[model samples]
Target chain A: MEITAIITALCLVLGSLLGITGGIGVYRLPDFFTRLHACGITDSACAFLILSGLMFQTGTSLETVKLLFILIFLLITSPTSTHALAKAALNSGETPLMEQQQTQQKREER
Target chain B: MLEAIYGASCLAILAVMGLALLRAVLGPSAFDRLMAVNMFGTKTVLLISVFGFLTGRPDFLDIALIYALVNFLGTIAVLRFFEGRKTPACYDEPAEEQKE
Candidate 1:
């Protein structure tokens, strides 16, 4: 029980740190695509860490099963939604910052 | 000790949520707003689960699960809504439009 508590605490702290980092990245990143990358990747990792920590606290029980389910669902959907958002943004003529810079460089070379 | 850890984690999660909300409000483009909303939803799930454990009512995990489902669907649906439009307004650059 002592070991489990330590592990749970470690996971929770690490997850919270990651979550805070991701949130800042999303806010401070320069481009939509970059922000999407930060949001999509960290969202899953943070949730996984936090949920698994909670699972550790619960040990083997129905709550653990539910946490597992939530984890799986988030893992699947977070990326999917991010992909859909990226595709939608691209389809709607939203250009990435890098692409815009590249085009400007090309125009300058011309 | 565990309770104190839970409380600290909760405060951190709330801080993250506030950052996400700031992004959502200050996002220069529609996509940024959408991304912020997605992040916010993800944090909400973590918050719900941690708070559930903190309070000794693990049953709130059910609400977290359902929230995760709805958030995904809502994000996708909103993305689809934006897909049909030609170009969403970008607040950062008003003089340029995507021609294409």
Candidate 2:
């Protein structure tokens, strides 16, 4: 009984740290691509860590099973959503920051 | 033990939620707002699950599941709305319709 409690405590701490770090990534990245990368990391690694910890805390119950299911669902969908966003940005003509600089350089050359 | 975990995680989620809200409010473009809203929805799911865990109830997970469904739908709806209506196949069939 005591060991399970200890484990749950550890999981909670680790999960909280990851979540916090994810939030930091969201704030610190500069451009859209960088921000997307940060969000991907948050959704993938941090989310898995937190969800796994939650599963451990839940142990072998049906809730734990549901938690695992959510983890898998997140894993598959998160990246898919990221891809959709990037593609949409591209399709809608969102210029890359690097390209914007290049275009300016060409204009200056002219 | 459960109470402590619940309280701490809830605080962390709230902190992140605040950050997301800030982004949503000050986003420079439509995409940024959309991305922020997506993050907020994801956080809400996590928050509901944690709250359910806190109260020793399982139904909140069901709510999370439903939210996930709606989030996907909402994103799709927004995308279609923003993309505007496609020109449709019949629009290009003016030559065929001319005979009718």
Candidate 3:
């Protein structure tokens, strides 16, 4: 019983932390690619952790199946969407600072 | 114990949703807003699943799945629209700057 309570508290604390960290990442990250690092972690990993705790409390049911699908969808789409966003950003000339510097240098040489 | 655990997840999920909403409000760029909207949709799926589990409703998962697909499609469409244009398309800015 005590173990269950401890686990519950842990999930609560950890989920909040993940949520807050992701928010900060969204706000603090300078670019779209960097933002993906934050949002992707929140979607792929943090959601899984939170969902697992919820699953434990849910007992065995079809709800589990749904959660499974949610996980699967998240795993597939989170990265795919991030990749799409990243590719579009790159195609539009959004590069990391170092790469931007390299491009600038190459431009000066021409 | 079950209620408490599921409740916590719901609350945390809401917080994440709120964060996404904030991004939607203060996106600084069309892409950031789009990311924020996508984040909101994914968070919504989790929210529905947790709520269904809390209430012992199996049918909700189907709705959640549909929601996930719609969210994915919506995001892809928005991204493609922006991609088709030479700019971020929504913000009318050059270079698609986000944050400082």
Best by DockQ: 1
Can you list each candidate's DockQ?
A: 0.78, 0.19, 0.48
Tens-place lDDT digits, model 1, residues B1-100: 9898899889999998898899888767877888888888888999999998889888898999998878887787786676666666543343555442
| Model 2 TM-score, 2 decimals | 0.80
| lDDT of residue B71 for candidate 1 | 83
Clashing pairs in 1: none
TM-score of chain B of 1: 0.86
Model 3 chain A is weakest, by summed lDDT over 10 consecutive residues, at A50-59
From the highest TM-score down, the ranking of the candidates is 1, 2, 3
**Which sections of candidate 1 miss by over 4 Å?**
B90-100
Pitting candidate 1 against candidate 2, the one with the higher DockQ is: 1
How far off is each candidate at the interface, as Cα RMSD in Å? Answer: 1.0, 4.4, 2.4
For model 3, name the residue pairs that clash: none
Candidate 1, lDDT over the whole model: 0.86
Candidate 1 per-residue C-alpha lDDT over A35-92 given as tens digits, one digit per residue, 9 for 90 to 100: 8898888899999899888888887899999999999999988999989999888887
Estimate how well candidate 1 is docked, as a DockQ score: 0.78
Worst 10 contiguous positions by lDDT, candidate 3 chain B? B91-100
Ranking by DockQ: 1, 3, 2
